[model samples]
Every structure is written in structure tokens, then in C-alpha cells.
Target chain A: MASFPVILFEGGDVPDSLAYRAGKLGAEAYPNVEFLDVAGPRILMAPISCLGAGFAPDFHGFIEYRATDQGCPLTQVMVDAVAAGGLCLSACTASLLACDPVQVFCATVLRLAPSIDAMMVELALAEAVGNAVIHGNLGLKSDLRHSLAGLVEFNGRIAEQLRDPTLAARRVQMTALPYGDNGVEIQVSDDGDGFDVEHELGKPLEVGAKSGRGLALIRKVSTHIEGGRGGRTLVMRFLPAG
Target chain B: MDIFTDSHSDGTRFTLKGVMSFRDRDAFSVILDAVNQRAGAKVTVDLTALEHVDSFGIGLFLLANEQAVGVGSSLHLLNPQGDVSRIFDLANLDAILSLKQTMPATGATARNSAPPRRIGIDYRHLGKAEDGSPCVGFSGRLVFAEHGHFQEIVENLIANGGPRVVLDLSELEFMDSAGLSMIMIAHEEAEAKQIALVLRNPKGAVAQLLSLSALEFMLEA
Candidate 1:
């Protein structure tokens, strides 16, 4: 692969100029970009997360984070890491919802670049920070019931839809079920000998793990977790983010 | 994809309106970084309009989650429409990333407290399957030559429980070490949890995978 610098951008709609200029000027990847619009807060981390992993970086750094209708806390976390690392960072007034105080934590791997164009594609630079903060507080900060309710509200408003609407809708309908103060029910079913729990849960769901760390994070934070081939179920008690 | 933002005096909120996949990482990265400047503020990611997500899509989210925590803030994903939810579930990301639904046009945002989502097996609590038992019901496909849908299977089991688990190998046509390991992982998980992790009747390709691993005897022996 050609040696290229990691270009992390704030998530939002990238104007044709920056997108075109970046691509034309040798940009390796976009963590989140869509169409001509780079709805971002994405990463072009270290040319590659690992050295010599041989990822088909095909059209990297072009992630399309479609959560504009709401807020995304994850976007802020990713930005803090990328920008905090050694890379170029930029932002846009439009990308920001408002100016609020936010702090993101990540191991220092990439550089942080603060720019105006960055905002156009940035998810948390200005607009997304608050959402991330709220995500941590929604459920856990309140009583158990409120936490669960906050979770449902969280799920209903931000999480799945932004990642993949089709999948999010299907999952919400198939898996999640609410039963009053009891909590929210999440069903996970599959064909294999009931999937692997040791690999996905109780442990970090990062790289090597089949399902990865995100799975572990969601499950851990959730109130309850369950599932099986005969049809499994994940019952989240709906606690606020702790 | 377009970017939408809702601003408040204290902070700002953003909604990304488009398909979330590998194609848009660059754009997404920039936006997420910008959000980090503000510490401990609330931001929301609305997905009532998202369409797809793959490995790259998953990566984008992982990137965002990392950034959210850095500056003392968090990410909030909202209103996943369709296909989007399945992507998360398949990736088992539903556990970490919130997958919200649009309350019926009923306009009743049932702010009620959440209840525990339960899994009551419809099948009887049948004991383990017989040796070389013929596999029966099966759904999903091979993810890897060895493991295939193994990870997904375990994810489901974790969120839900089954009286009897059926690893219908009838439809399965291949296997490998990864595949076998996945099965073992699931088996172990069930045992540890004291749940009945039964490998239903096995045959053909499905049977071959187990036999090759010499797990057949251990499974039913």
C-alpha cells in the first residue's frame, strides 16, 4: 500500500471543495463520508489501525454517519482519539450544534487537527458533544426505571438508526420489547450452536473478538442480557449510562 | 449524506442523514472530532434515515465511541429506521450502540421505564441430541469456513435463552477450526451459565465439520 498520512475530519456534510481537494490531494480514508457530502467526525487513523494488516482500504475515510436527525456521542469519542493523535483536524460552524464543554478519552495513537472544514464532516466537534454526554447520563444517572426509559429513548432516538436504518428498524422490531418498569427486552437469535458468549461478552469486544468491543460495551451497560439458537433474548433493565 | 444540527445555548446536537458505511468514513471522522471540543455536553445522532453499514460502518462507530469518552462526553444514537437495526444486531453492536425505534405514529413516546426483555423458549426442554442425530431447524449462513454464523449464534444466546439449542447442520455445508472453536465457545458459555446448550441432530457437511474436529464423540459420546 502507498504510504499516506491519516486524515481525520469532523463529521458532517463535507462541501465538494474539501472532499474533492482532499481526494485529489492524496487522502487515504474517511471514517465517515456520504455521497459528495462528508457527514463526518471520522478518522484516517495511522494510514491503518495496525501495521501491515492489509485491509482493503478501498474507499477508506469516507464514512457516512447518518444521524443528523439527532446526536451521536460515539462521534465525539472517535474525534478526540483521532485529533488527539498526530493528524490534521478541522471543523465547521454548521457542524457544531453549539459550543459546549466536552472531554473525550482515548489512548494517544493519532494526532488532533482543529479546522473549520473539519466541522462540516465532524460529528462531535461542536454539535455532537452534548449528545455523547447525555448518552452517559440518560439511563444510569436516573433511577433504574428512568435509566431503562432513558435507554429506550436513547435507542429510539440515536443509536441504531445512524449506523444502519434498515438493520436498526429490523432489530428494534425483532429484538427490543418493553414491559413497563421491568426494563427493555432485546432478543438475539442465530443458527449456529447458539453463537459464542465467551468471545463476545465478559471480555472486551475489540478487533479479534468475533462481535468486537462495541457488543461488550452495549451488553455490559444494558440491564440484562440473554439469547440462544432455540431463540435467545437480551433483556436490558434500562439503566442510564454510568 | 447530509448533516443536520439542533443547537441549544449550552451545547449543540447533530443528526447524520445518510447511509453509514465504509464509503463515508472520511466525512464522519471530521465531524466526530469537532464534537469532542465541548466537554460533558449532550449530543444526539439520529438514524431514522440510515440505510446500510458493513465492516467500515462498524469501524466508524468504534472510532466515534473512542472520541466521545476522551473529552468527558458521550455519543447518543437515535431512531434507527430499518435494515440498520439488523446490521447492529448481526455485528452484535446492538449491545453497545443504542438502537432506538419510532413510537407508532401514536405520538406516545412511552417514556415509561424499560422492562427486562425476556426469552421464553417455545420448544420443550428436551435433553441433548443423540449421537449423529439428524439436524433439524437451521437459519443463517456461514460467516467463515470454520465459524460462519457462530458468533451471531452466541450473541443471540446471550441476550436470549433457549430450553434446547438446535444446531441444525442439515443445511450447513462447510466448517473449519474457527467454526469448531465457535461451537465450542457457545457450548462452554451455555454450560457455564447452566443453560441447556444442545447440539441437535447432525449430518452431512455439518456432521463432517464436527467429526473432523473429533468433537462429535465428545459432543454426543
Candidate 2:
């Protein structure tokens, strides 16, 4: 029998329906699961003790709540993971305020493998996020980077998209999972129209070619790459030198 | 990215610090504008402090080189280090640009008092071709920084009314995508002028790239 704990806050903004759903999901996933309401004074102490005992919750569900404050236990857990080089999964809304997803993802991975080549990691992340931002969310063509006028137009389009709330509100999520003892699997996905991954992948790199180098460069740096969601999602595996 | 410019009687020196990528497009444009303003004046760009560069940055260098030709001046790159230097090597820019390990001494007094230019390229005119048309010979690497000089030389040859312009690349050791682009542009210009632009003796990686791109038609036996 497996057991899991679920935290429920009384004054938190999480809806009751969401909590019910989380409970149902947990019960269906696990045979023996306990939902712990940490709102009461007595129950709060119990949750704190569980956390002190290194009982990491398998599933943490927060609905319609901001967890930016350090006081949030879940947020603290993520921070600790980043500092101690542990597994962390994060999802963020695609907005200018969220910063570059590539930079954030690379920074986290760098913490795990400090000896890895920084430039290689940077190039891989840049290519991934660039594909997501320009081709995915903004719906810009890669060939636009071929000429000066086209590049200018591309930048202008990106700037315009950034200003539109409807476009900027789309979500881009990145997940860094452990592959092996010293390998990492990075997945980047965006909510946009997928591209022709097969066509892009098949194109050969030629001299004097203006565009179509980003994916090639990414593939060269990563150990393995796979595309999904009609090419809206990119999964790259990198092995850092031990 | 930070661009600092210092102008003297010898030339205008532009020092770039930080990563040169798409994010620095506006800043790079400003540098291009400055290069355009100083037409016919020698321009030197120092990239020792640059940490990284992307494809856009490489394209921008080619664009700036083209602009430098329009103004009748030449541009040179100095002191590329780390990944910045590696990018140039990977792009095989040595054959197309005038890349030097250090700058030339300006004057007797300046040679001792001033700092060496670090890396510089010298442009030499190779006189007329077999048909009495203009022949330009480049001896060093021609990377992004040397595109300006390469363009200026080609434009000057075109202006001389040569039926066929021969570019002697026997001594060139490397040529990157930017260099290839410049050559292609020159070829187009020559075609427009009804003149044949011939690439003479492209060796090593330059030959490989040209052949791979199926641009061997421009090569001369």
C-alpha cells in the first residue's frame, strides 16, 4: 500500500472544486492517500512536521494562487531544489515578465552540471526558445532571417506580438528531468501552431544559406532531439561530462 | 553589448564589449551608421572583449562591410578571443578577411608609445588580369571584419570597366559564410554589369564550400 499527503488551505484562494479534483486524482493514482487540511492550528503543525521529516508531496496542486512569497512551502521546496541540484519542474505563462524561458532553463541546468560547456548549453537553449518564440508563438517564418529587410521585419513582428496581450498571454513550459547519472532531458513546449519538423530536419546545411541553422546547431550540441505536438514541443537530451 | 569608438588621424577604432547577437541589433546599426559617416576613413573593430556572437551578428558584419565599401573605406577586426575567436575559425573567415595577430605600427613615435592594433589586415592591389581587367589578390583571412575592404576592392574593380574581374584566392586560407555572401554579391553586381567575375584558385575549405553550394561556375581554371 502507498500513501500520499495532500495539503488544503482554508483561507487560500484555491477553489474547492480544484481541491476535490486533486483528491480524486491522488486517490485514483494511489491506493492509500490522505488529504491533510493544513488550515487548522493542529493540522498546520502536522504538515510542518511532515515537511521537517522530509516528506515531499508527490503531487502539489495550487489553483488561482500566487506563490511568489518565500513563506510558501511549495515555493521554498523549488528554491531548495535549485540550490541543492535536485529535480524541479516549473510551468510559467508566456509573458515578457516571465523572462526568457531558455535563460531560466539553462541556469537551472547549469546549477546541476557546473562543468558543462556554458556556450553549448546557451546555444541549445537559445535555439529552442527562439523556435518557440519566433516560429511557434509569434508565427514567424525562419526564412525571414535571410536578408536585412526581412530580419528587421521579423524583429518588428516580434515586438508587435510582445505588445499584444492576447499573444503574450500564451504559455511556454520547460521541464528539466534527469536522464541518467549525469544526463538531463529538457523539454520545451509552446501554445502555438506547430511547424513542419520533418522538412526542417531534412534540409541539409549549405554554405551561404542565410536561415535554417538554428535547429542544426541545436542538434549538433544535444545528444538527442525529438519533436512532438506537431513540432510545437522540443525534447533535447544532453550528457554532461562527469 | 557596448560599443566604444575612438577616432584619430590614422583611423576610427570601435571596441565591442559583451555578446554580439540579435539583441544588439540596434546597437550594431549605430556602429554601421558611424562607419558610413566616416567614409574613406580606415575603421578598426576590436572584438577581444566579445563573449559570444550569433548568426545575426555575423550577418551584420557582412552588411557593415558592404556599407564600408559604399563609403570607400575599409574595416579590420582586431583581437578576437575565446568563443568569439572560435566562431571566426569555424566560419573559415581567415581566407576572405585581412586578419592579423597584431596591428601595424603607425609611426616611429606612435609605434613605441601607442598600443599595437592587435590584429589588422592589409589590402593590396594585384594589378590587371590577363585581359587587362582589374585583378585583386587577398592574402589573409577574410572574415566579417574584412568584408568592407573586400567589397570596396571589388566595387573599385567593377568601376574600372573590366570585362572579367579575377579574384586571386590562392593565398587565402579561410572563408566563412559572410565572405561567401560578399563574393556572391560581387558576382551578381558583375553579372549586372555584363562582366564575368572569376574566382581564381580557391583551395581547402573555401573550395569545398563553393562546390557544396554548387557555385563552382564562378571558379576559374
Candidate 3:
């Protein structure tokens, strides 16, 4: 089971620049399958045939190749596979503010597990990306939401920060991986200063409490939460009952 | 999010369609401004069509409640269903805002009975304190997302010749680091004007945060 081959499929729309970055990040496992063109049914059938050939036969999951282009259309075969209870994972590297990473991530997760509550997934992803953009990359404090003037100032600062080449160029890399038969792990990392995860986790958050509620909710819903690289990288695991 | 307003003799009613999240801040602000303008009128916000609400949206409701109180008007939340209501219940907003299943019938006698007051934010104009000093009372969560507006209101009160202000946080449920920063900013602003800004009754999370930050001296008896 440990020798199960992890396949990687590259779509036609992926740009050369993004491909280079993905390669440099070691986004995919070595000697895996790669599909460059979606012009034929082979791209969709390849995974099924691989499974039929007893290659990672016990493994029933999909890992999407990460790239910049979001226009990679899903085929009926892929949808059918997910519907048949096969887990699906997708990875994407997005710009700090240019892409709606939450939407894309949540949509993919929902498709993978349609039985899961939509709001729960949406909230979790929103908090993840929001933290990555506002607190991680932009270095905005959570308390800035306390006042209208502060919100205005916060917005202004976000705009100003994004105008800086160093800040704007920072990327947020997100990867969704299957953990077990019933669990999914989402890892989001931002290129910014991380915080004291232990200190934040130590704070006592009462139910109905407003401050730090998002992370608290995320903690409640996720099976396990792990932080690394000074809290710049967060991995959340969710096991929705099928 | 789309917000539609309808005016009636009793008050104005706003209907919110679609998700009411942080993304709808502009639309929420429009509603807040409209409600503030109609102070003294019974303002009702119908969330029956609302699909979802985030923490920031919930914070906006708390702020609107404070604004309503400031203008002598009342704000009522009408018919929040599914996720919208669940988020409200989870946050215990029902303890703070007036939640109604249905709106009052038009042309009916206006109900003069005040709604139950729960643990929420409110501002009181204290003409003078026990020591013959001017003061004000602020109750509820003074955390981020609500801090800037809260600061502005406090600043305006201070600018209006109130040299001394005592913000009452007895009912405050929570205060984040941002809230602490705002308080410090207010304290400094008051100091520059040769005024005293005191925080009264810091309890619960507010007290814990102040103590942890080693700024408990801001609290007064």
C-alpha cells in the first residue's frame, strides 16, 4: 500500500511559467503519469485504466496537478469517478489577491464530497484564504475589524501593501490531499511572517464570542489542525461523514 | 448581496437577498446609514432571503444595534432562516438583538413595549459621574471589525466637551488585541486634550486581555 503510485496530470492550458514554478516546488511525485492534452478521452480514461491495471489498486483518489490556469474544464468521466466514491484532490498556486482561491478550493472539495454541508466547507475555506491574504501576506491584525475607521484603514493598508512589488508578488500555494478513506487534508501556505500558533491556540474562546471565532470554528470542524514554518503553513483535516 | 428598502409609517424595512458576508460590507453600510438616518423610527431588517452570514456580518449587526440605540431608534431582525439564523444563534446574537418571526401588521398600533435588552453594545451619555466628572458608558464586544466605528463614536463624544469619559465594559463579552489597541489610541487622544479616559468594569475576556497585555491600569473602579 505504501508503494501506491501517485499520478500527476498536466492540462493543456497550464502556462510555461506556472509549470516551471510547480516543478521547482516539487508539486508532483517523481515518475508519475502526466497528461498534456485534453483533446482526447485518454486524459479521462487514463486514471480508470491505471486503477484497473492494479496500479495503486487499493487507492481510490484523484490528485489534480497544480497550475496557474483555472479554466481546466472537468470532464464527465472525472465527475463520474468522484460520484462513484473515489476521492479527488486538486492543487493550485494563486496570487495573493488576484484569484478567488476560497471559491475554487471549496468548489473542488464539495464536488469530492457532496454529502458534506456546504456552509461548513465554505466558512472553513474562507477563513483559511482570508488569513492567508490579510494576516499572512498583508500583515493586518485581526483586531483591525473592531471599528469602521479601522476597517477603512485596514482596507487602505491592504491596497497600499498590494501595490508593493514584494507584497503583491507573494504567492499562496494550496494543496488538497486525501488522508484516509474518509478524510481530506488542505494545506495552505503564504509567503509572510507567521505567528505564534501555540499562543493563539491557548486563548480561551467562549461560544458566541466574536474575537478569534473564525479559527475556533475551523478548529471545531477540522479533525486535526497543524501549523509549521512559524505558522505560515496551515494544514487542516476534515472527515465528513459520507 | 442585494438590499431593498421599503418605507412605512411605522418605520423603514430592509430586505436582504443573497449571502450577507464581509463581501457585502458596502451594502451593509448603506443599510446602516439608512437606519441611522431614521433614528427614533422602528427599523426592521428582514433576513428571510439571506442564505449565509460570516462573523463580520454578525459584527455589523451588533454595530447597527449600537447605532440604533445612539439615535433613540430600535433595530429588529426578522425571519432569519437556515445558515443565517444558525450563525446568529451560535453567536448568541439573540441575546443582544430583537429577533422576530414575523413583522408587525401595517396600520396596527405601534407596540410601545421595548424589547428585552441582552448582553450587547450600548452607549450612554453620562452628564456627570459621582465625582462630578463627565463620563459615558459603552457596553458589549469592542473587538476588531467594530473598533474603528466605536473609536469614532468615542472620539466624537470626547470632542463634544466631555473632558472625562468612563467606558463601561461590564457587559462586554469579548475584546481582541485590536480592541485593546483602539482603547490605547483613545487613552492617548484623551491625554493630549488633558482629559481622562477610563475603562470601567473590565470583565471576562476583556479583563483577561487587558491583564495579559499588562495594561490593567486603564480600568477604573
What would the DockQ be for model 1?
A: 0.02
lDDT at A106 for candidate 1? 8
Q: Write the per-residue lDDT of candidate 3 for residues A1-242, one digit (tens) a residue.
A: 12222223323343444334434432222223343322211212122112211112223333333332343323222333333443332222223243232443454565555556554555556566667767787787756544445556775776677677666555455555555755676666676799776677779864323246546556765778878878997778777765
Write one digit per residue (lDDT tens) for candidate 3, span B1-221: 88998989898899998866555767788668866885577889998787666556777899999999898888999987655664576578999999987743221111111111112244555467677666665554453334325555656657745467676666555554545656666666677777888888876556755665556777775
In candidate 2, stretches whose alpha carbon ends up further than 4 angstroms from where it belongs are: A1-98, B1-221
Rank the candidate models, highest lDDT first: 3, 2, 1
Give the Cα lDDT of each candidate. 0.36, 0.55, 0.56
Candidate 1: segments with Cα more than 4 A from true spot:
A1-242, B102-221
Docking class of 1: incorrect
DockQ values for all predictions?
0.02, 0.02, 0.02
Determine which window of 10 residues in candidate 1 chain A has minimal summed lDDT: A101-110
Q: Estimate, for each residue in B1-221, the C-alpha lDDT of model 2 and write its tens digit.
A: 89998988888888899877656778887668766876577878888677656545765787787788888778788876554554566567766555555743221210111111212123345688777877776554443324325545556657756578788776554454445655666666677889888888887646754664566877886
